[model samples]
Target: MLRRYQTAICDALASVDGGSFCEDMWTRGRSGGGGCSRVLQDSTVLEKGGVNVSAVHGTLPPDAVTKMTCHGHHDLPAADGEGLQFYAAGLSMVIHPRNPMAPTVHLNYRFFQIFRRAPSERSGTNECGGEEATEGESLLWWFGGGADLSPSYVFEEDCVFFHEKLREQCDRCDPLYYARFKRWCDAYFRNHHRNEGRGIGGIFFDDLNENMTVSPEKFFAFAEDGLQTFIDA
Candidate 1:
């Protein structure tokens, strides 16, 4: 599922970037699967951007857990608990427009996974069924994806429109969804090193899935609309 979806997103983005894509060098996962990292250097619409897709699983190593924690991952599941079954596919791109007037744009949308069941319980897992899987139960499923904008020069209208379009989509899913994620996005992009931020502000979130109150198909439509609005603006 992760590989197929990664291919789909790569195909869709390749058609638009107007540049040959190159795979990035990524370290093999300590736990399980690996990811395909693609980049477009000095692209027509970007400076150096990446569209990465990772389909990895297994328990996150201790180092990995520590790294995530350092990034304020106070909510990431434990590493040794049940050996999470992970799968993520998303497009992350930063368009550093030749015209500095055109603010830089960063967008990412991905699917996620957590510990659910053993290989037998879930079709994608390995033969080693963990203690939880042996108990005959499935893991909880969810999703998380969003797009944000950062203009070098503050464009209040652009920022407002960008957030508003995203808000509309969020409202369609759940009224609280937009406000919550919007605040998260604003805080998430802060550049502690610079004591400022990478750009003006956008949106950021995690833990979304097909089983949400809003169906996957509906969310897909909303995501597409949100992306289109961002591009069109």
Candidate 2:
């Protein structure tokens, strides 16, 4: 999915200009993992931008694990303990268009896996009745992400159009999603020091998973919907 989005976003942005996105593949520190970063700059449309995908694995620092709220994983080991294994992959992109009238936008969707050292099957299923199975010492995991529109030149109609499109997508995933996430976005993008918002409102959510009454697959589709929205908007 991340790979697909990497290409789709770059292709969409590239259409705005004849130039193609430069691809940079990078390896993580400690040889944990690697990902590709596709970027475009100084184009007729985009001033600068990047669509990046990364999947990395490492032991989180003690303090960092304590700060992770996804699936309430605080009790899990952070470092040299029973298991400190962690894996995270995400598709994140930020677009800065040359035209200030065209808003800068951001969309990010990520998945996390926190578990003990375990080698599980691809299905993650148990032999007993073929029930759902988790690898050794599985601790917690979930989905988190959102999209926002940041405009240097605010357009009321554009804001309404963007919000309405996102709302339509969210409603498909869950009828109650829009209002809840809309409020969440408003608070998240606020600039309390300046008493204003950094961008027009969009949806923001975190800690989404089956336990949270949302499936990972559904949310992933929602992420794709958002990517397309930016491509078209």
Lowest-sum lDDT 10-residue window in model 2: 124-133
The global Cα lDDT (0 to 1) of model 2 is 0.74
Off-target runs (Cα >4 Å) in candidate 1 are 1-18, 23-31, 61-84, 120-136, 192-195, 208-233
- lDDT, candidate 2, 41-123, per-residue tens: 98888989989888766665656666664446545665554335676788898989988888998888887877766434334
Per-candidate local distance difference test: 0.58, 0.74
Question: By how many angstroms RMSD does model 2 differ from the true structure?
Answer: 5.9
Per-model TM against the reference: 0.63, 0.83
Please give the RMSD to the true structure for each candidate, in Å. Answer: 6.3, 5.9
Task: Flag regions of model 2 displaced more than 4 Å.
Answer: 69-83, 118-135, 210-215
What lDDT tens digits, residue by residue, belong to model 1 across residues 1-233?
A: 33344455555555666776687644344334455677667777556666565544455455666576577555555556454444444445555555577777777666554443434443443222112222223244445667776677787887777777777777876788887887887788788888886576666777555344555666556555555555555
Report the lDDT of model 1 for residue 132: 20
